[model samples]
Target chain A: MNWTLLLEQTLNGFQFGILLFLLAAGLTLIFGIMDLINLAHGSLYMMGAYFAATLTKWTGSFLLGAILAIPACMAFGMIVEMIAIRTLYTRNHLDQVLATFGLILFFNEFVRLIWGPIGLDIPLPEVLNGSVELFLGIRYPAFRLVIIAVGILVAFLLYLLVSRTKLGMLIRAGASNRQMISALGVNINFLYTIVFGLGAALAGLAGLMAGPIMTVEIGMGEGILIITLVVIVIGGVGSIKGAFVAALLVGLIDTLGRSFLPDILGLFFSNDVADTAAPAISSMLIYLLMALILAIKPQGLFPPRGA
Target chain B: MKGTPRIIFIVILMLGLGVVPLLADYFDEPFYTVMFSRMLILSIGAVSLNLILGFGGMVSFGHAVYLGIGSYMVGIGTMHAVEDGIEWMANGFLQITLAIVFSALTGLVIGAISLRTRGVYFIMITLAFSQMLYFVAVGNERYGGDDGLSLYMRSDFNGLIDITYDNSLYYLNFVILLLSLYLSHRLINSRFGMVIRGAKSNEQRMRAIGFPVFRYQLVAFVIAGTICGIAGVLSANQTEFVNPSVMHWTRSGDLIIMTVLGGLGTLFGPVIGAVAFLFLEEFLSGITEYWQLYFGPMLVLVVIFARGGIDGMLVGLDKWWSRNSTVKNEEID
Candidate 1:
């Protein structure tokens, strides 16, 4: 067993987990507070990446492009909310799912229309392009490390906003009983939009970060969106803390399972059998984990209070 | 009087589908026969899905997984027959039976766990399970894996009917569609179906009234999956190939669209919805390369404005027709 390889994969898993958390946090927040299932959340992530890629090209600086893309994504999300999602709040989950499915189709085609069939590439700035040594003889990409750092910083800031602020109190109240909050003369509609925007911004950040790593393309959000949804479901639909924990768990399990399952299977079985089964089993690992979790604790690892 | 338009619409749709092959021959346009065959096969899937989604209110977003399963059964069966010299594996009846059994078992496992969760959780869980199956299919290298297996020949029904002929295949799909419709009609009105529908409207009330809602839902889920497997078999034959992409979540979304576009909780709506939805898709794609841009927003508008869909529109037309006839009769009297 190579310790360095294991260590490197673990760091990769952690980085991937952080990215999942960024997407899951906003998804959980919007779902928790608004009682809305926004399948188009992933589309916002795609938009963020597109915004960053295009803006970076214009500004000639990755930092400024990323900073500007957040607001652009927020504004796009708010517009979508006001026009399309607001009508869905009063409807059933099936309706929400179908309507948002439509939004996904629209967004994918919309991207294709504007950006053409090909994907856009976000170039890493010179400062973040190279690898840096972390410990003795171990080096990692500076950009990935930056993603981990930014994700942690954002998660910490989010924790403060949710736990230590008045708006956070209102958000908590809204999640528990939006009727009471509205009855208390709070502008619940405004709050809903703000939370939605905040969620969108978070998704945008995750997307922009993903751009340099993955191709900025149409339908890119969907593959990751499924993973994010799995993370949120495993964590507990409306719990931020749950999302964080579950994201890391899923990321590690998926990454590690793919890398190591074949070797482990080889010890017990023929090389041919192990090679054939590992990819299938490893790919199924997360979903199998999800099913097991749902079986044991259907409400997820951390059910929100009063949910 | 209210049912008049819907009845008329169903009759016309059935008649139209029944003659699709003959019409195709008359016009010398073989494409319509092929297109409608695909539509009818998928309508079977949509109708099966409507049983669980529309009546039972269990949104199994991974419904397409069964289609892939059914396809694989035929695809793998034929592959074994040809390569491994297992000739009996190519029998259509045996292949269909295996597809049903496998999909039913898959549905049972998926439903038992997913039905434990309600609402959006159910949706997400089902989606995840289907994805699991999709990945499994992709990883299976022996049966062409990700590229999928191409059938050298369609399923042999022991010379009962030759599906090699386009018309024969079309009629086969048509007969199956009617059988499924009949099955749905019987199942929906049956006592068991009442339990499923009742549970959908109000699960707690049904539970309080002594109905085991979860069991009823699970049964319906399995039944729907089995019927969809049949569709998959036909699909594999029609296209001569089966791939993992058939089980993709987007394909499931397409099924949901067909069901909803036709109308929910209606006997003939899904069939009608299949025709309308496919026609619109065919029509729109004919006009532009980016049909989804238009189609996506159109779907949103349908959900927003046309609550009941095309079937609902027919019902409204029926009401208006009856009202005008009644006024004329009153004046005559």
Candidate 2:
């Protein structure tokens, strides 16, 4: 009911949106560049969190744990690509889906075996654990702010990498036309492995950052996986810029809708009914947004050229 | 036309299924009935998937959503019949008819939007929509929310047929399954089936030949949904419970697996697949808690070595055996 509370919630939603971008960016890149539907990408995110949690426990430093987990995830990604993913490149989408889905099941059970079913807590470093005062008397978690800052910084770096770097050029070219890139004398197979590995690392970074705020559990990856799919679908698959915009939009709509929908509906319905209806409607907000976007633009907002 | 082999195979499979209770007298009747009913339900689901996936070449990851919708229809109808004294129609037959219609309508709307895209986008979109429906069902408190709803009694058959008894329910499911198989067989051999198959084989050629591929695919999708809807009705009666889990993406994956493992693009592949899959689950789960560790690798091996599936493998073996027998006879002569 309070305006400031509503404002704070919107900011919270934006922060969540930025986090989604970090995950979706990597997913869209791999999906776009390789034309592979990697359902196991979310597993990478889950692995990142678990790795960070265990490392943080060992090293007694959040920053050092995150730094170590990034490369570890990259290495893990390369191993997966070599052992399982390379064979999938020649198979049809259905096989890829089935194989990756099997990977998801395996990874979830693997995590359960290693970490047990109990949710693990990853505490923020003592220095950044408290709340920070922002605007007029509004305060938010300092860690969340840090997440937003990192998200934006990553986004900027991604732009520079995709738009300015040689790897980015190959990635863009590969996404636009894989056959042509291969014919142009590039080692398409190695490029695909590197892209897949980078994608995993990015997902790992998102998971590492998300550990403090969300419950780090075995199935945490599945829920966010669905949302990341929605982001890519709406933003247009294979476009980093599209993912960045769509992620923020989805994050805001989901957060703000959950916060304000009950109050908005209270004008017509009783409080009890409103409360029950609000959450369901709010959860559906992103899907409804997706449907509307598809209806208007079936190819998404910014499909990669020639895609 | 060579129809004898297929007809003989179907008869043998049916006889085998029918004699299950009689042949295994030691097995509990209720257990056989439950397993048979589940097979029937899942076969209906897999067959519907084949309509689109095999014939239409649309690999939908959200096909289970129809089953969910069908189940919800029964749940909601029963809830209204119990609470509001509102009859869905005049009788049990009409109520089931309404359920099929409702499920088909949902399929139509979802398909109309989803069939616009191809490949991975199509799969993801269908999955996203189903997940959307799942969350909605989970949030609805009146219907028991996450715990799901229980039916107070089996749906009334208006004195035409009694479903409350186990034997009666088993026979009902059996009759329905046979009818579905027959109908699916006929549909797959018809002119419409030819168009759908053509689309599956080569959409570009179908389009080049002036066929509107999307419309045909959409229609196939709706028919598939309606068939699965019937299965949903039977499932509710068998279990006397309905939940959002019916529409979960994993269930969709299971349906796809059933179709592929039995044999894609074949008339009875789904039925074979469903039976094999459920039996495997029952047998494997008995051995260890980590059954999936074994099961997952098996699936990968099947995809790798037996890409054509069990049915395909059987056919290959038969061909090789017949050739060997002919060679042996010539040497004896």
Candidate 3:
């Protein structure tokens, strides 16, 4: 394999992983702190993309549209929480699953009603449309570079928010002992809404950034949500650090595996056979990795304390 | 639980289904017969799902994998039975036998790995496995690949039963549905049913009482898969086609909806759920282009308010009616 191609794929994987990290962070936090599984989280991500596409078209400023989607998503998430998610907290996981499933059905059709079944487009700003030289002989798309840089920045800021802030402490405490924190007179319901809102915003942010690169479509969020779930499962649910590492690992493996598995398989199989089988096998690499990890460490690579 | 109301309900439902074809003939709307037949086929799927999800407390999200596998068996088996270059490999009987048996075997393998995890992990793992199978189906170029495989002719029973006709196929589905419902009913009341329920309610207690919980759960999983595989055979016969989309996890989600909407842990719950769920889809799609917009929110309200589903709500109504009648009698006295 060419070294330059390898380097480019590595960067692609990094960018993809960062987007996953954004999705996983929110999912893990909501799951971690609230002990609730929110399948509708992907719908929030889809909403963000739709919002960005719509606002950008209306205002003719991509940046302006992206900025406005955060609050819109947060507000949307909280309203949803108040209306439906609030009822799920006291119920069992099965009930949570079914209810959120209903929400998914609702949002999918709701988006269809507004945006129609076709995908929307987010026109990239001229400034971020070109490629940038990453190495002497290699170039990378400027927008993808921006995504990686922004992802790193978000990761850094998130690290600070969780480690050094009082809200972080409350979040950590809530994840650990919900009853204790509630008994201590902290407004648990408000905290939950805030956390859910924050999670929605992160998912939204990921959506907006991803819209330019990927087709901003009806089921786009769901396609990525499965991979994000794998990331969190590998990283250990409720642990941001775990989510980050696992996201990166999954991203790298998925990208690299797709690119290289066929060539590797070619050594043992005929070209026709390799070409046919490689795509299926490589696509399954992450799941196989998950099964392996689960077999050895059923709790995952980095389960949260007490989880 | 008292059986009178349930018995009355069953009698009415069976009668409704039995006369649907005659009614359709009178109205000259044969489409309703096909629709009811589809509902019966799906009811079998929902019932099988309920066995594991409700009674066994194993919320497998990939139950449709078996359905897909079963359909593929029909497609591939029929292809082989023909005078193809590949040689006539097997009879339709053997193919179907393999479908049901193979699905049970697959359940055992998948259950062995997945049942080790619980809650969300189990859900995700099952989903992942189903997707893996979906991709596999998508990759098989010989079987039509991404486009899916179409059957040349329906599975021939060698004149034992004529399944080429829609009405005949509908009757087959009806008979199978009744047999499965009866089988599950027997299972639910048996000692095995109690153990499964006991494990669901309290796994640790079941284990503490010297029950090999995992083995029992795995067997239940296998049984569910087998029944669903049978449903798949009916579905393939009904549709005259088999595609990779058959195993999509969303369809699995629909199966779960049937179980939950009908009533969890109840014998007749999933059948009611399938009917309600399908009937609503039929009604809404008839009225609006964006039916899911209405249907989705309605499902949410059901989960929120009718938490016990249509089956539970009906039972509650029965109890309420009996209590009110007794109170009236007391007042008169």
Candidate 4:
């Protein structure tokens, strides 16, 4: 195994993990604060990517497209909450699952109708397209570095927003005890909508950044959605910090496992068998990790005290 | 007025299903066999889901995993049997039995772990486990991976039953469906079913009454998984293939839709649901390429307008019809 290849895979894992953090952060917040199970959260991610792709084509600026898409996704998310999800907040989890599942079907089909079934590509801006030299003569794409920088920047901003503001305090209060927040006259409805919109924006940001690296398509949101769920599960469902750490951990383990497991296994098994088994085993690593985490701490690593 | 009318309605419905093939034959059509066979297989799956979701109050979002496991069992068993030319030990019945047992074991393990949490946690955990299975299926190349596994021939029934012919298969499925319906009815009314239902109504109350609610739910989950496994086996045989798609979250969603569309907590709800759902799917798909454009909105409408589902609507209609007739009868008397 080449050291350079290993290093590159490690970076790739970190990048993937950061993207997962963006998605999971929003999901956990909405779930914790609103007590809503929005399975269609993935649809918001899909919409963001699609919106960015379309806007970039029209405006000829990737940055502007992303800027426009974030607000669009937030608006869409708020509308969905008001029209459908608001009623569901008072219902049981089963109703939430069923209704949101319907939303998924609707959104997937709607995207297909509008964008067609084929995938679209979002080219990286020319200024950020080239590779930058890293350690040991290894070159990495500048675009990927930008993605990492953006992820960190967002994480910092999120940290400030959640820890510093009065809204943040309310959010924390709401997540811990919904009744108490309402009793305190927090405009719980407006708070839920804002939280939902914020969650959608985060998911949208993940989608916009992911569009350049991964294929942009109607069903793209679903693959990431599952991983984000895994991240949230491992991270303790209500904590942004936990989501960040778990996302990075999951990303690194998954990427490195897939990249190196076969090579390692080749020492004991035939190349063909090793190749076949590696992928399956690697895909299962995160789940095994999740199970291990839950086994150790059933409430999750950073479960909110009241939760 | 009570049992007789219900029995008559059921008998008429069954007879109507039984005579469909004859009616189709008269019209020189052969599609009824396929439709009925599909209905029978899906009904088995829906009924299995109803046992847990309706009676036990465990809304598993990954119930389709059992179907995948059951189908894969058939594919793997047949692959080995053909390679070794094993006759006495490995056959269709044995394969199906193994599939049911394996799926039940999986259910037991998953239920044990997931049942530790309640509500949203249970849904998410079950979904996560199924997703893991899906990923494993997609990545494992030996089992055909993403392209899925195809059988060279349908499973042999060893002359104990001939399922090669469409009509024979239809009849066989009918027999199994009827048996399942009967078994489910019996199971629901049993003392065990009572405990499960009571647990669903108020778990805390049941616990206060000294019932071990978790064990009862786990048992229900296992039984439900095993029944769905049988459906999966039949599905694989019908399609002559098995794939990871069987365990997809969408498939599980479909099962939930069928259960809700029929009527929650009703023994025969899932059966009606499966039949109506598949029929609607077939009809709608024929009308447009994007049939779900209509189907999705319709589901939303159903949730908004008819929360109790089509069965509930029918019961309401029955009540209205009876009340109106009673007034007229009183005037005549």
Top lDDT hit: 1
Interface RMSD of each: 0.8, 1.4, 1.2, 1.5
Q: After superposing candidate 4 on the true structure, give the runs of residues whose Cα lies further than 4 Å from its correct spot.
A: A267-272, B1-12, B81-84, B87-90, B329-333
Ordered by TM-score, highest first, the candidates read 1, 3, 4, 2
- From the highest lDDT down, the ranking of the candidates is 1, 3, 4, 2
Each candidate: what lDDT? 0.93, 0.84, 0.87, 0.85
> In model 1, what is the error at residue A45, expressed in angstroms?
1.0
Model 4 agreement with the true structure over B51-86: per-residue lDDT tens digits: 989888998989999989888888877777777776
RMSD of 1: 1.2
TM-score of each: 0.98, 0.94, 0.97, 0.95
Report the C-alpha lDDT of model 2 over A1-307, residue by residue, as the tens digit: 6988887888899898998898899889988888778888899999999999999899999999999999999889989888888878778888878878778877887888779889898877887899889978788888988988998999999899989999999998998888999999999999988988888898999998888889889878888988999999999998888999999999999999999999999989999999999989999999999988987888889988876
Q: What's the CA error at residue B198 for candidate 4, in Å?
A: 1.9
Question: Would you give me the overall lDDT of model 2?
Answer: 0.84
Per model, kept true contacts as a fraction are: 0.84, 0.42, 0.55, 0.55
Instruction: Output the better candidate (2/3) by DockQ.
Output: 3
Candidate 2 local lDDT, B1-333, one digit each (tens): 333444456568778877665544556555876786688789888988988887678888988888877677678778778778876522457657877898789889989999888777788788888888888889999887888888767777887898887667777777788888888888889988888999888889999999898888888888888888888888877888889898888889999889988888888888888999998888888996666666776776677678867778767766776678789999999
**Docking category for candidate 2?**
medium
Off by over 4 Å in 1: B1-3
Query: TM-score for the second chain in candidate 2?
Result: 0.92
Q: Which stretches of candidate 2 lie above 4 Å from their native place?
A: A268-273, B1-12, B23-26, B80-92
For model 1, what is the alpha-carbon lDDT of residue B225? 99
Evaluated with DockQ, which candidate comes out highest? Answer: 1
| TM-score, first chain, each model | 0.99, 0.97, 0.98, 0.97
